[model samples]
Target: MIETQDLRKEFRDGRTTKVAVDGLTLAIPPGRVTGLLGLNGAGKTTTIKILATLLRPTSGTVRVDELDPLRDPKAVRHRINLIAGGERMVYARMTGRENLWYFGQLYDVPRAVLGPRIDELLALVGLTGAAGTVVERYSRGMAQRLSIARGLINDPAYLLLDEPTLGLDAPIARDLRRVVARLAAEGKGVLLTSHYLAEVEELCGHVYVIGDGRHLTEGSPAELTARTGGHRTVRVTVPGASPEVEAAVTAFAARAGTVAGLDRAGDGALVVSVSHPGEIAGPLTMAIVGAGGTLAGLEVTEPSLEDAILALNDAAWLVTA
Candidate 1:
């Protein structure tokens, strides 16, 4: 397991001091994927670097598998691997097979074991056929696959992926997600940082949202959405709707602590906002009907992960202010 307690990191530039991470605390246990999310300049990369023992924290505590990284940097490094996105970490002139073999050797894997491990990793990342191809000839996605394979050369127990699918096409990204899921299934503790909210929603069993280097919230996606006042917009088609029906719908929505907006479609449909749609759907339908309005159609749209994240950030700013 990897964990931190009140972790803090700062940078000094002559007369200016900048705090990159402020009292951040989180746990990444084995056999699951934990997502780290934040906006640009939010200290996400800095936090990852600190955890990897690439940079020492100014204060607070950090541990990997119960070993303090500061005092046991080499041991900690041996237990974890970081794959930073957009970085050309592979040797372009070497064959994909050679690159893996080189990294395996660097990690001190025995010659007898390194060969088979290289084969397995290439297959794991779907690069078995391209193993003999030079890294420079590989496409962006292929190089990324090789990068992942390189990171796993030592078969570390913990993996850190920063924007692993940053610039890939949808199909390529989906393939990478499958590899990530497979890694977790193999009992590796994975800490994934991505800007794709939908990707985080799909892959991460637990997510942590941070802003300005401080944690905003942490929970399962569903729990986070619920805590952020999960809402849905319900579009109700009510033809020939009278003023009484509109007033009654508006009043009901207000009582439920939701805002209501009405737009006259060519067919005269009313769109209503339901704060707690799962709980208010029935009542909303009844209210329109009970108010002497004929329902023509209804459509509901639920709050997305992006919406929940934004709400959390807004709440954090409100508190800080």
Candidate 2:
């Protein structure tokens, strides 16, 4: 596990001091993808840098695979790698293969295995054909792919991906996501930070939401959303309803207390937003039935992980403000 306890990091410029990370306790276990979520300047990258041994925490205990990054940065570096989106860690003049070979050699990957490892990684990241191409000639997406290849050269036990998919087109982003999942499945502890909430929902088995450098909450996406009782939308096939039936259903909904909004979907289905779908689903169905509307189907869409995290973050800031 990669873990931190009451982690704190600060920067001082002249007489002014800025706290970038504050009292954040987090854990990323192996064999799973853990999401690190926060808005801009929420200390996400700073926290990652600390764990990656690129920045020392102002005060805290950080351990990567039971190795102290502060006390033994060299050992920590061998076991962990941090890849940040929009950050170019490659040399423009180096060919993709040369970049990998250089990094592999740095990690002491043996001469015998280095060649095969480079070939395998090149294919893994869709860079095989471009292996001999100078990195400066590669597009942004291809360059980002090379970063992934570079990060994996050491086959570190822990991978920290901060916005790994940022700015890439959908197809390329998806390919990288698969690579992340594959790494975790191989028991590499993976900590992913991305603004793409849906990606988090799909990939991360657990999530840590941070705000203003504070650990706001942690849970599986479903658990977090359930805890929030997230805004839900229930769409029912109220097909071929007459004006009278629609009016009856509206009146019934009003009397049944309330929901956030009610409207017709493009297919003329009834769509209703509610704070508590569990309490309202039955009444809604009955209303449609009594109003003589055909109910062929009903589906409740729960609020996304993004909604839960943002709502919780807003609440926390409101309390502090």
Residue 234 miss distance in model 1 (angstroms) = 2.4
> Under the 3 Å rule for N, CA and C atoms, how many clashes does model 1 have?
0
lDDT of 2 by residue, 1-321 (tens): 999999998899999999989999999999999999989988999999998888889998998778887678888888988788879888899999999999998888899998999999999989999999999999998999999889999988999999998889899999988989999999999999999999999999999998889988889999888886686766666667777666776676577565435667788766544445355677777877787777877887778898898888889889889
The deviation in Å at residue 111 for candidate 1 is 2.1
Which portions of model 2 miss their true places by more than 4 Å? 237-246, 255-257, 260-279, 295-299
TM-score of each: 0.89, 0.91
Q: Tens digits of per-residue lDDT for model 1 on 283-307?
A: 8889999999888887887777888
Q: Tell me the lDDT of candidate 2.
A: 0.86
Query: Backbone collision count in every prediction?
Result: 0, 0
Q: Which candidate is the best by lDDT?
A: 1
- In Å, residue 187's CA in model 2 sits off its true spot by 0.9
Q: Residue 82 CA error for candidate 2 (Å)? A: 1.2
